[model samples]
Target: MSATREDVGGTPLPPGWAQPAHQPDAFEISTTTFEQRATETMARPFARRAIANATDHAAALTTARFVGIDHDALRDKARQIRAHAIANLPDYLDQWIDAAEAHGTIVHYAADESEARRIVAQICRDEAVTRVVKSKSMASEEVSLNSALEAIGIDIYETDLGEFVVQAMGDRPGHVIAPILHRTKDEVHALFSTMAGRELPNEAEALTAFARDRLRHAFLTADAGISGGNFLIAETGEVLLVTNEGNGRLTTALPKIHIALVGIEKIVPRRRDLAVLLPLLTGHGTGQQITTYVTMVAGPRREQEPDGPERMHVVLLDAGRSALLGGEFEEALHCIRCGACQNVCPVYRQVGGHAYGWVYGGPIGAVLTPLFRGQVEGGELAHATTLCGACDDVCPVKIPLHDLLLGLRRRRDEEGCVPRSEQLAFALWGQVWSRPLLYRASTAVARGSLRVIARDGVLSAKAPLLRRWTAGRDLVVGRRRS
Candidate 1:
């Protein structure tokens, strides 16, 4: 089935994985540029619009009411639960395998992204699938699954509304919970009109209706369905999917073959843990009693069921998660994708997702990127945050996000990954500070230099290597007294 303009409208294509401009070797350069870009972006009308939606007073009040329990106590309990699960991951993995296999589900293990892609591609080729419908899965994004599938001549359709928009626009997700939050209504209207070959309304209801009508056909005609698991229950061998949209239900149930891709860290010891998490996710993400759809698929449909898939496959991916599990950074595995960090983050609130130059954004991205790609390729992303404790405050699983970012920074420093220029600057600063006379002389020179550069108490002229800093804001110089 071909995707209609209505179906693909307003959604950009998935973003190609690439490094962003402003390559900074040292934390100081990276931090400075990050601050500059974040400040500029937040000032834009578009960024303000997106922030309004997330920080809506009504929504915040509703969420506060639902999670009426003490925030600190709940966070502590959730932290302990995740800690226990991570500590005993191996045992849970074994249990998950045994239980899932018992229910006739085929399980595959992948060591990395390439292997994971190969395994999923082989499955599609073996099944002779040409088209697949998929639910939203960050694991899929991490592995670039759609590109891998397309490389093998398979057409994949994203069933989630936000993901579908992103897939069509060919852009990476901007936020975990609200992927298209960076876009304005006007931009979406223009995109939809181009795809639909006609004018489309900018109203939310009209846009949603157009997408629903377009995706309905893909659901009925797809040969296979793919999804990412929110939780893997070891006790019952069930994979749980939590979504605010009903599209997940159709994506998983309507196809002939069903496949789930999950990171190994998603495993939970029992089904009951969901009791605490379901409310937490809703409270932290969208403030609902429950997501619109919560699905638990144990295996393929039984003889009694007439409408479910016949074959079920689960691919459990390691992809650096195993190495991180036993390491000091293991706390990152507790992430539940509630996106509380991004919402509360000053940096993310300003610059949005594109500045981070990765699939994940905000505090979680800082830690995950470095770990996934190693400090050499993704070390710069680690310095994107201000080390604020807001992320820690809102995390349902209570990951110590700021501490993790600091740890990554230390690792980056130890590896000598920092730029030579920044290193030299710090070394010089240290030398001057060691002697009182040298420090005083340096301060005197700085004061004189500021006077020379100042124009009416503001330094507006672009200084050498300081052009970016002066581009937007004025730097005021101190006036001399008689």
Candidate 2:
């Protein structure tokens, strides 16, 4: 649903604030069950095709980049770097704050999303910001900052083409890196044609030109720019942003006031870590040596700097991240957001990102969403994965994504968020497995029962509850002969 004027505050929302096509219950995943969301997303042929195409394209490019190279070693090294950084996050944060302050940058710490949103909104209000332009930042999305600022009549525009398309369509992003991955060229063209009052050509170049012309104007005329950092170097207090498109540079450079909203876990201890991170991130994210534009901000613009933001602010957002530190799930904080896990996940590939039903998606999202929001808010996300370990294998930071997901599922079960039927089923299965005689009897009974509903060699949905599993693929009972 779109953010209404009342939802924001009392002021009117800007144009294009209506609900989008694939609007998941972002705030409340329990509203519609995860199965319902996944089933709906799986029905979208275009979304599934787009995810498959993007995943295949990325895999091929990444393989090409790693030919005769020690990709595993690089992954290990990257993992170590991130692990070390997150382990000593407090020290790194302090060092970063001192360095950035020395460089004349204003730094603010937000313990939660509300504080983060308030800090940015206050910044805009203090600066009397009438118009704002932003780069794609998941941190900003986490806080719903656009709606907060827009509620107070601050007109905000997303500069990234995918983000712009998503914003224009008033929809949530399907994928992290490629927000509009679920959308096709024709869909975008239709959206543009509706806005332009002319039938825009359904072509890549034509769409690019149309978007470019419009965003270029937004870039040149916005009051303040907001961006998310891929890495925040503690040694130099620099915020590093990577983008395939050059819009990030434009967004940060053109605006007089630049505000960076980033998760606290983005910090690294040393400057040289960029060497390992940039290549690792780009390789895993898009199969490139590096993104086309890697903008590094030491702290706003220096005296000698010819062009950049005059005033820069970095909002260090610690919404449940600080609590995760030094804990069993702390490894999750090591993610570089390479999006490799999602690309390799079979479940994500088939259902697409929207099925996860939150800001972050895929296996990583399944882990992080519940981790951040607790079982009450995001427990269902834990069941979105297949526990296939593909995500763990492909993670550049070597985060044990499957393990973390299992942890979330365990936590959910312990917290009693899991349905009673699911718990009882598992308990009964456990009882059967623990006793040898019972196991054989249960297996015989299961096979006999399956034979009743069995068509060919596979079991069909004999009950309404069984339909969830049997809808996609049939379950087969193997022959008993050894």
- Model 1 agreement with the true structure over 1-482: per-residue lDDT tens digits: 54332343245433431111333231111333445546655667676667656645424744575555776776677777778888999899899889998887889999998898999999998888888989999999888888789766677778788887777667667888788887776766766566566788888788777778657767877889999998898888889898888877787799899999999988888888888777777777776768888998888888887788888999999998989978879999998887778777876766777666556878898788889877765687778778878888778788988889999999999999999998999999999999999999998898888777776777874654466667545788876653
- For all candidates in order, the CA lDDT equals 0.78, 0.83
Model 2, range 229-278, lDDT digits (tens) per residue? 99889999889998887988887899889999999999998889888888
Task: List ranges where model 1 is wrong by over 4 Å.
Answer: 1-45, 48-67, 434-465, 472-482
Alpha carbon lDDT at 154, candidate 2: 77
Q: How big is the positional error of residue 91 in model 2, measured in Å on the Cα after superposition? A: 1.3
- Model 1, residue 113: distance off in Å is 0.5
TM-scores of the candidates are 0.87, 0.91
Which candidate's TM-score is highest? 2
Candidate 2, lDDT over the whole model: 0.83
